[model samples]
Target: MLKGEKLGAAIEAARIKKGISKAEMARHFGVKPPSVQGWVKYGRISKDMLPRVIRYFANEVGADHWGIEPGDPYAPDNLVQLRPKLSAAEGMVVIDRLSVQAGMGAGKLAEHFPDVIDNLRVSKDWLRRNATFTSMKNLGLVTGLGDSMEPTFSDGDALLVDRGVRDVKVDAVYVLSLNDELYIKRVQRRPDGAWLMISDNPSYEPYVIENGDRDHFQVEGRVVFAWNGRKL
Candidate 1:
């Protein structure tokens, strides 16, 4: 069976056992229906989605609810306990998200080497943090969302974003927004007071910001460091 199929079986079994419809399951997990379906049938979901699934199942039927002790051969690791990791095959610049069995192995890596990996990613920018923003100053976590900055800022990379710095240099990488949608891009200001969004990955398209749209976009902060690996 494909990996997604294994994930699908596990999801199907859990939903049936818990009396949750696929739609309810999607809502409970805060994900799209197709994504949930993909998990059960495709055995895969994005890195950000794995934790949610784990929490749902674990809350409903796993260790906290079922009293299944760890290390028991019969103990089942539910989807709610799954952690996500990234994998990038050679020649593929884009990183693929991999769902792992939390507190266990991630696919073949789990079967071969346990406790050695938490997560994985291909971009070095995963370490960029916002050095100076109110909450970020204290939390030091980067708020990464969206896909325009593909190959650099993934849809779900948990950044150790510093919030201490606010100044953005022209043509530098900064997290900003337009129309309430967040974007990560290099800023190139024109003499006419316009900005251009440049993506590092050729796989993505670049955009030019109109003067009228400038007010809609505000610099959240600059990236300093990020973490690209899986969560333990």
Candidate 2:
């Protein structure tokens, strides 16, 4: 029962599976970049653009295709509907944890680190929260809050961060914030007391944070893993 936009998302995933970029696809179709984005966003490439897309990704269509489901062939709800929001109390805690790690949340605290919990260390247990924290030993989670990290991270996806903390290395992706809005972007420290926040998805522009704004910005933590309701 897939229709309209869901169908378009399936095609987009198929395109990713094939290692093609949207800008490249737009060029292939002799169309504008936004035109291709519209196709991905709405799940419908215009009729004039369909032939070009079909020609480019010809081998991807299912053969003697079986009937499809009502949502995305993969991660259906993410593609087809808005996700349910966590309760304000729950969201507040998650946001608080992120703020704590990144060195700023919403309120001031005399003692930022907690002495109350023995399980709070950044270990397999901290991430897994289970009898056996084996599967998630190397994983961590962070909340995304703004569009500077768009295309790579949406407004609410709980990012799966990894254990690589400490210094900000070149080309390493970090979950950080400036002026209280958190972001996940590739970081490359400059010799001049500034840093570049590079967006992995090329559709967005890259920007830098100056030394003057450094106090308002800090590396909350590095992202080694990501998870959302639709992705793990």
Please give the RMSD to the true structure for each candidate, in Å.
14.3, 18.0
Q: What TM-score goes with each of the models?
A: 0.36, 0.35
* lDDT (tens digit, per residue) of candidate 1 on 131-187: 323442122344355554555656656554333445455456665644544455667
Q: Single out the weakest 10-residue window by summed lDDT for candidate 2.
A: 111-120
- Estimate, for each residue in 124-161, the C-alpha lDDT of model 2 and write its tens digit: 33344421211333334445555545555566556655
Evaluate all candidate structures by whole-model CA lDDT and list the values in order.
Answer: 0.48, 0.49
Q: Pick by TM-score: which candidate is best?
A: 1
**Between which residue pairs do clashes occur in model 2?**
102-220, 160-225, 160-226, 161-224, 161-225, 162-224
Error of 2 at 48 (Å): 59
